[model samples]
Target: MPAITVSRRQALLGTATVAAAAALSGLPPSRTLARAPFAAAQAPYYYRFAHGKMQATVVSDGILPLGDPSGTFLGTSKEEIGKMLTDNFLSTASVVLEQNILVLNTGDRLVLFDTGMGSSQLFGPTPGKMLANLKAAGIDPKDIDAVVATHAHCDHVWGIMSDDGSRNFPNAQIYISQADFDYWTDEAKLAIKEPAFMNAFIAGARKNLLPNRDRLVFVKDGQEFLPGIQAISAPGHTVGHTIYMITSDGKTLAAIGDLTHHQVLLLEKPRIEFAFDTDPKQSANTRVRILDMLAANRIPLIAYHFPWPGVGHVAKQGDGFRYYPTPLQMVLDQKG
Candidate 1:
């Protein structure tokens, strides 16, 4: 793949039209397209439904830097990985970390799954667009009835709090798995061999959840978060990473949070676990189970890290899986 260096000015111009549209419609400034030149191309947000009335929107918060891929996935050969990246029109060895947040509008209530990294230095200017996107979709944070977290990972949980350390969604009740909450908050777990990263996670949890403890609800596996959203326990990514099932009308969508970081490498090679997974073996097993279920049931998926507008269907391609993105443009055109 050729190296594409987008200029900052071009980036800003590309995003300006979207920002202008949001402004004309009285949306928040954050959702305004970045004025920065195009350092990298931006992906569009998308929406679809499970059942019929339940609406799911994929709002992209932003992308994170791609670090080295060495030793990340199990049995992943650098040469093979490079070939796969090239095949996907991406540069070998450089993995762009895409951050996605899902909004499910279940008629009576609006729920968001996994907040994105909120206005942090790590996310640059594109950070904290979830709220803006929500507004663009005619959703008010105050209108959100609940916020469900897959795990306590920084990217997944940080958006729960604003830059000034306040709950972003003032009216929403926060829900997280009991296992994930205990693991990140446990001092013993924080003092694991890799204390540094654990400490950072601990700090983030304190900053995001400690003060609002009363409003936060700890969920158990198999519990129903809403009429159509059921919590599915699929641990190993963290202590309690979860996959939320939204079954409505006649279709189903699984909001699988951080089950796998890289779609191509992870989906195509289900057994190869990333280094970030707490228990690679268990994570791999969970991925395999979810992939098998998705293929068997022919259900759509909303992944936190699969390319932007991360709503897609998974298909069994021989021994592996393939992602079939539900293109936002096509959906929008049909809606029109």
Candidate 2:
């Protein structure tokens, strides 16, 4: 609930490490392209699955490889973190975070949740592929009925605008939590001095969000902005951070946004602190509570930063939890 202020040192220890690395190093964008770029005549980076009657598309925005987990993951040592990674059969030296953009078709309305990096070059050359992927998924940006954001973080909101800083989704109404809309748009607070890269976050948020003020709808907890989609107030990663629960025909899917960054470390050690969280203690508390409920209810989840097509279910394992990735099931294309 307090004012959000980020420093370069703090960012280095959080999710912003990639941004810090790209900015501080003054390095050039890598000649290497992100995997399966549509620009290179590759397979489309999207997976289509069904959540009850609604059709969901998980679009890829490429991956960001954060160099190390040392300071970024607090309350644990590098050796301990490395061991956890090895135990889970994951990479110990680096963390590869996925940027999954979810789209849903609820019969009448075409809804998009959380835009990807969108041509932003701040975190290296790996991101900014969401727009192309959306097209590959056979969805046009102008046809989107609603653009709902879980929060205003740079990676989540930057794609709302085009390269010329104009509204990208011209026909869509923008929706966000009232709390985050107030916090990120506070120009005075964002001016209090922080890392240069942090400033880009602030600027990017403003440019993308402010331009759509008239069309922006501020939502609250438990409010259903649409027919079957309701907002769940899950704060701490950022003030007013939220996740949407989509329910229909006796089935429910939780569109979890940034609740947990890593599949192994965060799920196994829910109490571990994250430097990127606006309120670490609160973030962990919310995470544990949500994970417990999801595991108990056996609800499937779509994680924003999990592996590609981040659809999975959680199970309680001792003092921790284990992720059971939902096996891909083919759904035939709808006939006209």
Candidate 3:
């Protein structure tokens, strides 16, 4: 039999004709597809994974909308900051940071790292969702054995209590650096009033820390306050901003409280100082030092204000470093 082949012109015309016919017939109706109403809300913002011997849960306190990148992140030209954000596919108009609150369920106790903005209207209403998220993750606030704060910054420590000065983690013992505890809660800070936001920060610190004075364990550098948890002093972001290293079995994860706020801005340009830092220059230096160590050793870290459930590793890039967020382990990753 002779071969019968369709020419390129014929094939193109046939596809166009079929497409036109389908378009003219209008939308198709399925015989069995279920019609459902739109779901306006998202599922719980909590991620759980096994970290060696510890069961780790990363919960969202909520979003923190920092107004204008220029006012928040400084020590660099506004143009540079905007360009950095733009290149990373981030918003240049404002900085919206996530509060990735870490909870560790070691065999014996439940330890929470950095409480989110509790009733703080400091940055508005997007935050203060920590309690709700903890509930969603089936974690009882009262059952928290220890509350470790990276610093006494508003977003990190404001959620420690209610406006009425009630303890949020009533039964849990609190751990914070003595420097931050003293510096933030000091009445004297109210006197050195250059930045307007300093008052609220000082006030909030006093309100929350004063009441819990007895339960507050001033964290010591390299001290093991809780099982498998050790504090590393990383100052300058605040006077006492600390980083925690969690060791389980033979594995470790660093809970870097606020070492770097924006992954792109700070990681890409480590010298760019944050406006809120007690000493911006020192913060930048400390950031470089710690990041260099983490990058050299290939240690994984969870940044508190990075994207939600911020678990990642850093690599030395040009003058700074690059953050590579690890995929969320949705299921138990058991080794063969």
Quick one: best TM-score, which candidate?
3
Q: Give the Å error, residue 29, model 3.
A: 8.0
* Angstrom error at residue 191, model 1: 4.1
Please state the error at residue 223 of candidate 1 in Å.
2.0
Q: List the residue pairs that clash in candidate 2.
A: none
Count of clashing residue pairs in every prediction: 11, 0, 1
lDDT of 3 by residue, 164-269 (tens): 6578899989999999998998998887678888898898888888888889998899999888899999999898899999999888899998899989999999
Encode model 2's per-residue lDDT on 118-164: one tens digit a residue.
88777689998888888888889899999999999888998899978
CA deviation > 4 Å runs, candidate 1: 1-51, 122-126, 189-196, 329-336
lDDT tens readout by residue for model 1, 1-336: 223445766778778977787789998757635576665833435455443666666677777665556545556788888777788887665577777888887888889898887766553565566777777667778887899999987888888888686778899899998788877767655566573466777777767877778898888788886788899999888888988998877667888888878778888888876877878889889888888988899887878888876778889887789989875644432541
Best-to-worst ranking by lDDT: 3, 2, 1
Q: Considering lDDT, which of the candidate structures 2 and 3 is the better prediction for this target?
A: 3
181: Cα error in model 2, Å: 1.0
